[model samples]
Target: MNDGPGGPGDQAAYDVVVVGAGVVGTAIARELAHHDLRIAVLDAAADVGDGTSKANTAILHTGFDATPGTLESRLVRRGYDLLEGYAAATGIPVEPLGALLVAWDDEQLAALPKLKAKAEANGYDRTRVIGADEVYRREPRLGPGALGALHVPGESIICPWTTTLAFATEAVRAGVDLRLSTRVGEVVAGDGDRPHEIRTSRGVVRARYVVNAAGLWSDELDRRFGHRGFTVTPRRGELIVFDKLARPL
Candidate 1:
């Protein structure tokens, strides 16, 4: 990946340039590497897995509760299968620990059937309603007066950092250029038979096609291209990683 402090002449021209080295960008880079094309991945961080990807919880959402027949639901389902298979092939650890949506009140209890129906409509039919006895039988140390739970056995977790690393590694191994710490400042579209110019912190990069996968800054980049359909607002979340000994508790 020509990460040297050399000028644009030292950097090889690319057919496609992906702005972001996060999981999504890396995955896109890897997939494009299969084609016979010059590809480059640029990111603002010093290394991959920085930004929101590093802080991800690694949970593989099953979309069991997602609205049925929607684009998001379909994409989630397809992406889940692709990721699951990729993880298995690449030795990325995935834990299918499953999940239980517990109900402590009557209103929540009455929602289990609807949730299960939604799951069914989304083409996931393994969800089931388990009574409180079964809930306590599975999780014996629960508070009193619990009603029921929706057991979704497809929920799983994976190593988010490893997944991103794996994708970046494969993409690099396949000859995709990776340029970290190169934040894109401006994007100039290309004309017919000409290349697009990406103005970055390091230098200008020329590419035939540009992909905006910059995550949080994607909207800002879109604005540079005269499109403003969405905006990104950062949100904070707290994560607690428990040791193996805490699993029993």
Candidate 2:
């Protein structure tokens, strides 16, 4: 992974330096590794998947709730299919149990058709609206009253750790240098034709190009480059895993 003597003065410059060893950075490095270029993936963490990449609900979402006609929505849909196939080909276990958007009241139930329409607009049309009877039949112990539900049979669950590790592993095997415990402190832009200097806790790294996939710190990194376009507001997402017995409810 080229951690030894990798400082700017000691090691040669890389063609591309991707900051952050999370799934996105690793995937980018893997994709770039196919070409004839020197590349490195750096992260502050001790290991890959040590950040938000490891903290997800592990749902292979279908982007059914995403607003249609948006870039994020489109990407989500495309990425879902890509990852689904990637999981199958690479042996990443994924359970396609689908999802139920339960509606408890008349107002929510009334929104089901619009929500279904939105899903269709996003290129998913497999949703089915089931009545209270069917909802209760499927989940007999469901509390009090679930007036109706929208069944999305394509939504599935996945293993986020395995997914990130798989990407990092493939990138490393494909000749991409994986540098851990490397925290980028500052970026020194190069003059025309010169390489950018990245000051890290470990040492300085010179790269012809840099990609910031730093997750929570991405906006901070962008500001380092003198950009004020957007800001990142970190939010907390909690996922609770229930036992198989809860399946009845």
Candidate 3:
């Protein structure tokens, strides 16, 4: 794994270390390129995007209703705008297929207006309630119990594969050292005041700063740093993708 330019015990130094090569991690690495810093992005997989990043529904989130003013909301909104422009710059595909939140019964139907109001509160004012006739017209194959639906026009599908790859490729081309499969096993302090030394399966690696974006393994990494700030409950979702010819929506 570490058999690249530097062999075992080479103990090379990097200005910054960004863990994980998911879309978010790669973007951080790319953003660091503006500074004259030696950055290294690490991943446990043999290739990038082989984790939860590869799976799940491929929706480009609008982050509407993300509590409006928190870090999550801010980053998601910024990432949405950034990725939108990036998709245009590159050739990544995105289909603006609006979503229809169906209401199957009277109780569910009563929730439509509230959902629309919530969307408005979330700075997404495009959502509105559609009558049954229009709902049936839009989705001809909808189940018989649907009374109405809330139309969210900003929802869209995206190609997450290219999104992650684009950030990784650009970061690598911009001189970010991408260390693959070099799993960090332990951390050793350097000279009682120097950068933290990461002991990996390959050898010792040093970094002045570290950004932990380990996703599911975030807990394990926090323990390695002697600080259990948070723990993770990894949940995996399974989606069955019908063939493109199956239907177009």
Candidate 4:
């Protein structure tokens, strides 16, 4: 990455400016770098992946439980393959330990088949419904009362930090400018033959096109662009870390 210097006044006009340097933003920047466009990635944080992307569970899902026939399901299934391959190619650490959606009650146990069918519909057919005996056999340390489980062997864990860094690094190497600690506040449309003016905490950035990957602040950015198609409601999740002794479980 170019650690030389970054600010609005230090850079030239860009063909495309991608707001937010999280995983999604950096990925978009990297992909855009493949073209002939001059791209710039802006982030409020001091570094890439400093937002919610760093705090995620880092699970490489198999889309085994996504709602079928939706864009989310299709993208997730396709992204799984793409990211898995990218992780391998970039030498990002990945542990294909798989996962088991344990069913603790009769109602949930009955839903196993439905989940398997859903996975199939999402183009993932590697799911298997296993009884309690098999569940216990596979995970003997698991608590009792698991009626059954949907075993998704494609479910894996990856390094979220490495993944985002890989994307940012590749984007920078491919001639995409990365501007960190630059928070975008407003976007002003320009007239014919003029680039849009983006006001940021640091200074102004001029770009012909702007892409929003701002995650939680995407809705706010959309509103700045004179659109209110959706709202972003932040959700919280907790991650518990255990010592190596708990690795077996």
Best by lDDT: 4
lDDT of 3: 0.81
Model 4: which ten-residue window has the lowest total lDDT? 1-10
Per-candidate TM equals: 0.94, 0.93, 0.91, 0.94
Query: lDDT of each structure?
Result: 0.89, 0.87, 0.81, 0.90
Ranking of candidates on lDDT, top first: 4, 1, 2, 3
Worst 10 residues of 1 by lDDT: 3-12
TM-score of 2: 0.93
lDDT string for model 3 (71-184, tens) is: 877777777788888898898898888888888889999988988776666667888799899999999877787789998888888988888888889888898888888777
Residues 55-170 of candidate 1 have per-residue lDDT tens digits of 87788988898899999899888888999999999899999988899999999999999999999998889999999999999889877888999999999999999999999999
Backbone clash total, candidate 4:
0
Q: Write the per-residue lDDT of candidate 4 for residues 1-249, one digit (tens) a residue.
A: 333336335445789999999999999999999999989999999999999899888999888788999999989989999999999998999999989999999999988899899899999989999989999999999997999999999999999999999999999999998989888988887656989888877778889999999999999998988889899998877779889898877
lDDT of 2 by residue, 131-190 (tens): 999888877778887999999999999999999899999888888888888898888887
| Each model's total of backbone clashes | 0, 0, 0, 0
Candidate 4 Cα outliers beyond 4 Å, as residue runs: 1-11
